[model samples]
Target: MSESVVADFVGHFFAAGVRGEPPTGRIVLSQRRLVLAADEVKETIPLSSVFDVKVGQVPAEMEGYFNDTITIAYRVDDERRVAAVEGSDTNIDRFGTVLFKVLLNGTTALVRHPARLGGRVTDADAEKASLKLEHGSLTFKRKSGPFTVDLGTVISVERADRDLGNGPHPVVTFRHIEDGTAATSEVGIDSARKTNLLGRYIRLRYADVQEELADVSLDEEELEVLVALYSAGEGVSLSAVVDIDPQPLTLLLNGLAEKGIVVDTETGTKLTAKGRVVVGQRLESVNT
Candidate 1:
């Protein structure tokens, strides 16, 4: 082939291989193997099927070494073929480049610059300027400047129309992110709904309740557990619930104990009289 033709062929080959397609021809160099696929590989490999690809040679019987062959180590590019056979311990810069390529290729939504702020979200001015959404976590930038809202801190994120110096800044408001009792009651009402409904009464109810509860709340997770406890007839063991880790649960329980919402007696957790009343009142308010 001419030089130009050869270069073009190589480019096609590289692209094909990177996309997991079978190439018209194969290239093998010593222990290295490259297969160009004839067809295009799907966008992303299933996360579950991703396994480490062993590259280079290793001593026989070394852990995670394939057949004890000691060569240049590399991992599988099962997820992102760009670095499918990248060397082990790849430099951070190179890894970042490959990761970016993978993300682009996969067309994933990545947050380049997440919002950084915190505190209560409200119709009032002070909270609005501090509003942000960082990595799906709700935050508010303080009037003083940038500040990170702690994960456990309760905040409101109201969605309003882009202000154009017009009337009532288009309030199509809803709760942005809420945890604790608010989240719990919302989840409960959602769960209690029957499948057959004429309209979206339950969902509308949920939206309204969410907005209301957002106004008055505590730690999101604690409220969630409390709601769960109430739903389970005023008590649930720490082991039964999924999604929440134990350390947070311990902290939440302690917080509730201090607030008199939960009593940690030797018999296990039961809502204090005040706790029951608080939970009931919250539930009633949300439902209304």
Candidate 2:
């Protein structure tokens, strides 16, 4: 690979994977691991565990655009993960070459550069509905329905123009992670940027999900308890929540109070500052 490619490969990059357009983030190479990162997510895998690596492309609609793509599939114990990140047409070859060399070397290297600004997405539909990102899941909800998708289950993210003979316009499609499955959704956001944004956001956040959770403090039952108290004004009895029967709720409350996620008074329970912060993440999840 050329020196320019090597230089560019080491630092932060604007990477667009299977999703819409590119979201800004960086990839880190270490002696033992490879890390892919974005604003809200970080995925790291052992070099020995990475069994597959390839450079390829998805078809491009326009003539001049580069179709260069880099994809990786790796295992963490019994779990497997795959990611595809694309580079621009002019630089794709170099980017892949440099990365391949480093990984092939099988040695640790350290490089650092200030992160550059990456693409961002905004949507009007997001204003009408609530969109949240959490625990490797992306959820979009309205009165019509609350649609939740796991990032690990994502197949592909695409922005293209198709002609069914009637007309041609840009559309963004998200596919399922399962084989032989069609796209989960294919709708045109108002603009290309907005469409790209949603897809990138999902991919970036998905990287951070752990295959097996080991922390009891942040477990689902505990989070639900905080959310329940956050939603309930002043306080509500454990009997009010249907998700957990009273016995389990009773067991959970002791831990929640100890962690300061909630405050229990003689009459009822409420969220503490820490608890409110955790619950507030429910909305920030979409903002990402």
Candidate 3:
């Protein structure tokens, strides 16, 4: 094991299948191994054994304090195991972020913290993603919130065309699965190489099939219209999409209604859930 210290987070580690109480272990990540030490009952897991890590809030409890959960799943002796730990929401997150980057460093160039490779994130409102990429996951953090994703379960990553109205910004989408369904996030890519390479890497690594497309196909105009409706998120005026000529735009919008991607609401036009999924590829194509 490498002697260099990376990140060490102290917390109560709830080991899987253990007969006794949860151990107060310091989750330590060195160059080679991830160690959980509580008193003398230390369990050292090789980094290569790590398969995935899931981080999320675990139903806030007690009127006073609550913490997030970090679930680490690994393969051992051809058997899979899981351990979940809870701590200061912030520290628990560091546990996942640092460990993931270190493991991925073996395959990619992410030695220093990734804040330098700045990226923009659009979640409700546009912000910075303090983005960090690991071999098997990616994390986004900001003053408002933090998000962590397991790339192994990621289904798709794609670069979106620039929207002149929005800005000449190159966007990238990262879609992953939860509860057996797919979800996606859109973020701005400052570096062309980073966006394309990350997409190719995640898709090649996780997706079961080699092809990137679903069955549906749309021309540039059709795709653009759907993308517009998705951007509205709720019912909005058709003119918001494009009014190059009201006659042609209305004709196309109504055409999409037949496809069930859009509906003529009293307020204006809005995208149906199905339309958001299939046609919104204009939006993460919009999502499920």
Candidate 4:
């Protein structure tokens, strides 16, 4: 596969994670192969299983954590099973105080620390997870809380805390599930409305196309330009490709050319091999 294709696949994989689907893609982070898929994951490393859990405040820019919060980081045997729960006391009306109470009760959930010999925790007999120090690794899992988490379905973890003045209240930030990252840079904002709408369209259309449309590296407008050029079947000036103002179209074409997706020749503008494949995939998508 081409580098652009690989980048696109990585972007989509991250995007899918941000969107909360069991992502199916291979990303070589730090030269390690991490595979995320729907059913099973291979050669994946959990951030918590390998790292240390630090209790502090999540950055203000990190969406959910407004006041104070605690974070857990460890590497899991498989990176794909990562899950996070983030909540704050401020939104108690919406998210409840289960996660916050866990932090206050000083009780850890059972899922955080798995048994050496794998076992299961059922709903009826579930208990709070405790922090266990084993072989230089700290492990624990949450027990009684609002979240009904499946051990096999987690992919990332985040936690937030709020100071209710009397004491510190904690919340769980569920990071792996799709919270509309594609629709908004930060969650829980007015702009998220539009982001969610566009995200829904991408999710709906993503699976229909073939020829590895996993990563096209083009935004909506760039994709539109490529599609128009492909549909024209001949070299078309930048103006003819889009109805929008000329300056933005020129910038988009320039960006595509820099990415090796399009070429600007003396004749006019045309799709490169990569661009053609993207256009063709999109075309097929529209037809089907």
Candidate 5:
């Protein structure tokens, strides 16, 4: 309660035995806890005790009553409990973001935004930034602005090396799409523990996106074409690269295009951003 407040909002808190009548109250989020105070009720949930925080969804028990909601799952005295709060869409989203940062505060990293673009290394300067993770995004908060990477648009994340102020350090590099162009960013966490934690969370989200493509099967030839386009960048001759006839390569490209994996551009046939994600996973699996 004494810690600095991260976010404060007027919202509705849902608890058991309320029978669709939740309490309208002040929702307070601090560095260490979340406090919901109403006229007749006050509930405090410690940040450390929270095991999961979900945004844009309410528990089944509290559904229909609230649409824009954040559900907090925590434990108290060895008992698991769930609480839901309803607020404006923006406030609910802000609460989820703030909660994620509060739980992982003090995680600093050297960030290079647009470290690479379209398979080419960039000259962007590396700077110190605070890390903030959400379900769909990874953000680096710098004085200039927050550089956010949309997980849905991510093509690949890999371990790499970068010189961040000192000597060469291990860093997590992400390749994704920005403004319809392939882009990359790098983050060198200050410690091993922080790097591992951040990587784990990011890969979990990446896995979810990968899972959605599970049903789309690709044969060896198709896979070859994808990998070729990924490696060759744009203006790749699919027929020559895959050792297939031009007619068959046209069919293959059409198939991939239909699957939303590749597209023809002004330069040539290229892997769509999603196509890069697909090939990146396949390549990672092969390399490891």
Candidate 6:
């Protein structure tokens, strides 16, 4: 099979031995290796050699010249070496994300899509998939089709031990938004290193989403109203569900709407996408 190109960009490549101005080159990333081609020299680094990838941070030796950088640490000929790439701030950030995924590409896993939906267990069966990681998302390519989860919409990720035909082992279960509804997925990687690394990366990214939600505070009554709306779905009398009066329930729903958590449709009030994410987080927190 031919190696697929993962990413290609024009950036300045810097190495420890290079003096003065670094070489401006076209950086091409493939499934097996990375190639940097400049005017006179071309350097190829195998992806397997890459041990660490650092984003948004310039190495000490490469500092003072560039701001946004992606430093790649690898071993060549059994000797440790480092190379830095500099580009536009956004490009550097995006390339770093792609590079990180490329390093974890082709991981094998058993995937279960829609393992749960809105507190209800789903009937989907787990199947083997080839993991494909991308910027802000990861894909599970199964025999039937491909299923992807956007990390930005992820609410919670937890580690558990489960038996999937084989003996009980570590698995990762995460809750995310699918078609504007809360859903859960489970994955069991073939190797320990890849599994834990994938889990840690997802949690780190989810932490950013949690930070944005930090300023969003809800009182007990408000939370009760939100949960009621989430569970009972739309067009129901939320006041009856939560044992609150119509007047107070209306006020609570209005407050939630203002916070972009709930929406009042023509027929009834419903939880918005953000509302589902919040409720999903709450449910996962309670379950775990």
Which is the better candidate, 2 or 4, if ranked by lDDT?
Answer: 2
Task: Name the runs in model 6 displaced over 4 angstroms.
Answer: 1-6, 10-26, 36-43, 51-86, 100-107, 112-126, 132-135, 143-147, 158-163, 166-184, 191-197, 237-258, 263-268
Q: Which 10 consecutive positions of candidate 6 have the poorest summed lDDT?
A: 192-201
Question: After superposing candidate 3, which stretches have Cα over 4 Å from the reference?
Answer: 57-67, 106-288
Which segments of candidate 5 are over 4 A away from where they belong? 1-40, 45-107, 110-128, 132-135, 139-150, 153-204
Please write out the lDDT profile of model 2 over residues 1-288, one tens digit for every residue.
112223233232322232454444666555456666776656666656665565553334211333456666566678776655555554555555444444433221111100111112222231123445454455555555655555554434566663222246565455432221222344444434334444444444332222111232487667766666655654456567647877778778777777656677777876554455455454235335
Per-model CA lDDT versus the true structure: 0.34, 0.48, 0.57, 0.36, 0.77, 0.79
Residues 1-288 of candidate 4: C-alpha lDDT, one tens digit per residue: 211211112211221234433244443322122233333443343321323222233433333422333333334444423322233434221221222222222233323212111122222332344433221112333444333222111222333342222233342322111120101011111222222322222222222222234454667878888777766665446576579798877888888888778897778877764565566445546645
Please list all clashing residue pairs in model 3, or write none if there are none. Answer: 280-283, 280-285, 280-286, 281-285, 282-285
Give per-model TM-scores. Answer: 0.24, 0.27, 0.41, 0.26, 0.55, 0.67
Clashing pairs in 6: none
Supply candidate 3's per-residue lDDT for 17.
Answer: 41
Summed backbone clashes in each candidate are 27, 2, 5, 43, 0, 0
Q: Model 3 Cα displacement at 55 (Å)? A: 2.2
- Tens-digit lDDT track of model 5 for 42-76: 88898777766665667887776788787877778
> Per-residue alpha-carbon lDDT of model 1 for 195-267, expressed as tens digits?
1110122233333344544554466667667767766643567648736788877877888887667887776
Candidates arranged by TM-score, highest first: 6, 5, 3, 2, 4, 1
Candidate 3 per-residue lDDT over residues 1-288, each given as its tens digit:
468888787887755444455667788778778777787577777766776665553422211222467666677897887666666777866666666566543232111111111132323545555666764566666556666666654545676664323466666565654322355566555555444444544554454221323444557887777666655554456465564478888888777777666787777776554454444234343333
Best by TM-score: 6
How many angstroms is residue 140 displaced in model 4 relative to the true structure, after the best TM-score fit? 62
Off by over 4 Å in 4: 1-216
User: lDDT-based ranking, best first?
Assistant: 6, 5, 3, 2, 4, 1
Provide the RMSD of all predictions against the true structure, rounded to 1 decimal. Answer: 18.3, 18.1, 14.5, 22.2, 7.3, 4.8
| Model 5 per-residue lDDT at 67 | 83
